[model samples]
Target: MFKKPTTVNRMSQPEDFKNAFVVGTANVQSDGKLKWKIVAIFPNAGSLRQHGNILVVAGPGGGKGRIITVNLISWGHSAIVIDLKGETYTKTANARYKVDNGKGKVVVLDSKNGTGHRYNPLSVVSRDQWFDLAAELISVTNGDPFWSSVANDLWLAAWSAAQHARRPHMPYAVELMKLDLSDAICYFMYYHKDDPATMQHLLDFLGTRPNEEQMAKIKGGNASRLLESMWKTVKTTMTIFNDTILLNLMSGHDVDVEGMFYNGGITTIYVIVDETKPRVFAAFGRLIMKTLGDALIREGDKQNVVRRPILMLFDEFGRVRLNDVFDWLDTLRSRDIVLCIFLQKLSQFAPKNGKEFDESDENSFHHWILFAPNNPSGRIGKLISGMSGQTTVRADGGVGRSVNMDGDITTSRNVSFARRAVVEQEDYETWGADQAYVTLRQLRTEKYVVTSANTDNLGWALPPEAQPLPRLSSYVSPLMPLPSEIDAATWTAAQQIVEEAGGDDAVSNAMRAALGGLGMAVTV
Candidate 1:
């Protein structure tokens, strides 16, 4: 006895909404003919600016991921891509055309064996913020108050000492575990011996180590004991430092965060990681998110103009353990930072022991695009079904039977059913590789057949070889900081030693042994 509300369309036609950006075309029937109709990816630039963040889900070789990312790049958007296989975004020289839209410059930060630009995780923030930065690098969470406090203190102490000595921002993890309390005290005293004010500051910072009396008051030995336990925990979670390439790369300030984010040019940071080295990718991924997020926050406080939009594409998001990504998603959207998280299924985002996703804001992104999934009855299917809402359904069936008493008799029965999901599980499983279902908060759902911008009119697809290389707006340098006291002569000698040893690791071990052999004799 209830009437379903009539579906109302606000736009008389697609053209009524001017300035709408086309994401792709959809098969539509207009004027009694079936034809491809241009579909707006976003209603307008304002909508995009307001709700820029997007979540892209597709399976292997789905084609939607490439189509969407390539389109965005061609639109002159700035982006940072985590190149997992090294072929998606920046494999070929011509692939640069996908991102070179005259709006910005692209810089690739290669972490695969230290052949690319260097990125120092600690260089973005001031010395005062080193404590927090160090904790993040170790993947510290606030789940346990006591352990959190212990880890924070341990990281702060080690980071403080390093900053005071002007050492590498992120030192070897082994050094953190092996810090000698007495040696740390002596190092501070000897380094700042001439300056009384500097010595006092160092003393007060190092004074947090609980003395004998304080140790007796607690069941545990003292603060130092707690620090050691926390260091063990930190060491177990992160193993990138064990690899010389990762340790060396993280120790120096390589990528310029300010130039990438606020330079008003198209800046690109390409993170290339080998499949065999997933741990390296996870570390670099976390660093990229932290560095960029912190830099933008600081710039927001300093700059007078509104923040510009920046797009970030994560190729295989679920491959890495991004524990803090939930927090980033909740905060970064407001900072004018857009993140495109690519995953294969909704189950990937689900918590290990909970029904919901790990983050409360997992569904906070205003726009969503789902390509055809392999299994619709699975987690992603159920999620998309729920998101697509429900509609009234009417199914009618008739049955006939013969009545024995009347000789010539007929019986009829009818069955009816209502209530069905607009997009069923089977629908998702049957979608084509190039097809995608796009949904926005206040707009009607659309189905897009993604293709290159002018591929349809050109009547032929342009292969990677045929694509032109993009023009560079500016030159990006890869010069990173080196030990100040290690003069040119010393560095040249070290290089010669490395060449003779036939490997970087051997040379590094030799240098460390050489420094240890000097004992207290060497002084800068």
Candidate 2:
């Protein structure tokens, strides 16, 4: 049953609903309208975002170093720096344990002073991966030419040897190259004709012990002379030896695998091979990166992976001629191997006039860190902009209006409106010489717009005097002993050979003596 409401009068004065809702500075009146003074409006600051990889791009002395240092201090992640320029991060700063969270160890491979080193790639990577690197080097040099086939066949043969010798995990393919395929291995000391027979003979000598006839053939040819001049030539050309040491450094040691990991707790790794000769450094860089990718893949296959995801930062990447690096990056992301590649200008990547650049699997890098583009409207600039999802708008005249005059007899009024409309948005155009971006994804990616308040900022680029130089330094230290010093030590130890060989048969005695000095014992 519904009960009729009875009004009960109380001293509470009907408890004013407006007063009940009112605060110190705002009120709801009897009309049921709320009023308040407007103070300020603020937007949300957005999410605190983090990326697995961060690529810093700026011209020399543009504050990249400062930014990188700040980020390293803020986030405690491991970094493996390939200190190309010995000057970027000085030893004083690097000596401190907490600078890069103790993960910032510098590998200085300086070719100038002849103190470079090497490592065993097989110790860290699989056989197949090493071969891939070698194959890439060959492909870059040969492209679609017939020499690429030869390089492939040579690589396969070397790979087979590594597998047969139970060195599937060793860098036997690279080591096989050390045995001197031609007298040219000694550089300017001698030149062997670029013939298949000569190449095959060199391979046979390295892979197996040659018989009497084969040795006689080699002895009668330039091989014998090369064998004699090898030590002298190695002494004169310290740069070549330095390059070899760099290769050995990437070859991981058998015992201390952890040491090779460069496990400093920093996210960024600047492999500063900046001081190395451009061609040699590029070759080594390609080899090390390829080996790293292969090693990570192999480790991923294992039950327990010890290392974290790595960022291989290739600064001045175009100089290295590691075009095949794109392919490795394309596939390695799933295994957590990210590549942070830097190039001076995109146009430098195009093949020169009358030369064809390899376009196989172009568009390999997932992210680009571009700074101070030389030609914003150039082909490479447009291409990069398109890949990075940047857009440009153009406006043109759209509509007009006219009006008739109302009062004046001799004057007529006309009204016209200037209308603005979007005319066109340019898309990247493809060219035969230009590399294509085949890998495009539809994902909301994040990119930070980095700008400096100071115009006089000094960063990674070279100083004013060195701007016109063709190549930038990418020097880093090696993992092994300096080959030049080692070779010198070996030669100093060989003085004993000349003394021992001064007998009835000086040639035979010299052969035996030289072999013994080289730490090899010959059986009668």
Candidate 3:
């Protein structure tokens, strides 16, 4: 808990606060009335525009959850909070769902705890986006371009086939990838050769029979080339989709962002993720970020009836990569999707040893809220000192005796003033825990306020932990990766043929037959 200093906090006056997003609330007094803490921000000047985006810089166990989040929920802003510990959802979901007297909806993607709404990440993705989907799931190395392209091609093929097979989820896609490349090629070439809806370019890429249009011969050469490229993708996907709880969480299409928030009554969506596995969890995190924007845009095209602007409260912002953050910072604002990025420290922005972040990354947000105090000489403190800008301070002058070159004595006095920083660097270094610096970039002035130390005196009621959400019983449970994609009938036929071939296991007649006809074979 942060202790406030005895003296009142002095800051620049707040001005140009049009469309002001609430930052903090007043500390509880003996009267116990919750009042908005509207500290002065650029009270001397005005600005034309101020974006709603906020960047909250704070450390763990601070009052970010209690001061900022609790109030925002109480203020009834639509949010997509990344509740790492499920604490935010547990405390706020009841009030959020019961808003407007039971019309509000709360969507929880609580895979880590294994109790929440289930969703199929693939169902929301259209067929044309399969190539993009492949890009997200697989991390191609910088070492080779040809191999990456090959992997993407293989992924696209398997992705399409999995969707065609009615199980387009990651678990199913991973299962499809584990199969022999030629078997999948065979399914596309022979099994769906006559089907008009399949990808013909892919078909032509992997050649057809001799009498037809001569396409690239993929049976031996292409399949072998593509087979090894899948090692990285298969390993990564397998590791992520291997969790039973994650599979169950993504079992169906229970997360309807379009119906719920875009067109329906649901305003807040809380995704409880495994904070330990940021990279793995980022896949799903990225999915939610992209899907929500897509849903809003898609629905806006039809009716364009939007009453409230949407806010995405990303609690563990530093857990996600800055590369992804930069992309998000560029895209979501225009669609009325504002982001409230809660971070622990400045270094946390560049999680991967500073490779992913640079000086430009800090400018992405419209406003900055600092909860962590810093050393006066440190980079962050210096930056805050600069942000506080300079103010005029008057100095009174007294009469003094002066002698001119002509030997005449005269008395002269003058009053002078100089501009000094509103809040000095040393102040930041020695500030108590309760103090936070609010920088309104548009207003061009730094502000300060003392946040409440705990959640005890919050104006709004916290949703009780016993609040229950409606959950479906049947979810996509985990299953072992299938040994191979060959069916029972094909396996039986292959065994009989190979048994007829004296049981040779080295690419035996049984194996090729079990491959379900890579080349021409006798119809039993």
- Residue 268 displacement (Å), model 2: 7.9
lDDT of 1 by residue, 211-306 (tens): 355345444654424333433554554456455555555655645566545564556666777678777676676667677677766764555764
lDDT of each: 0.45, 0.35, 0.48
lDDT of 3 by residue, 283-358 (tens): 7776666566556545534554653556677887566554556565545665556677777766667533456443
Candidate 2 Cα misplacement greater than 4 A, ranges: 1-69, 72-75, 91-96, 99-118, 137-270, 274-276, 303-307, 348-363, 372-376, 384-524
Q: Among these predicted structures, which one has the highest lDDT?
A: 3
- lDDT (tens digit, per residue) of candidate 2 on 1-524: 00122122111111221111111112233566322211101111121111123233345543334333323222223334445664433421233234343444334434334333334555565444544554556532213333343344445554454444454322444444444433222211112223333334334322222234434544354434433432232222223323544544444332222433333233333345644367666656665566655665555444554555444545555565554554455455554545554454554443323243322223343222333324445443443333211111110011121222111111111111111111111211211100111100110011111122221222433334423322222433311221222244333333333333232343435344434443332222
TM-score of each: 0.59, 0.44, 0.66
User: Which is better, 1 or 2, measured by TM-score?
Assistant: 1
Give, for candidate 1, the lowest lDDT window spanning 10 residues: 394-403
Compute the lDDT for candidate 2: 0.35
The lDDT, on a scale of 0 to 1, for candidate 3 is 0.48
Q: Look at candidate 1 and tell me the lDDT of residue 450.
A: 34
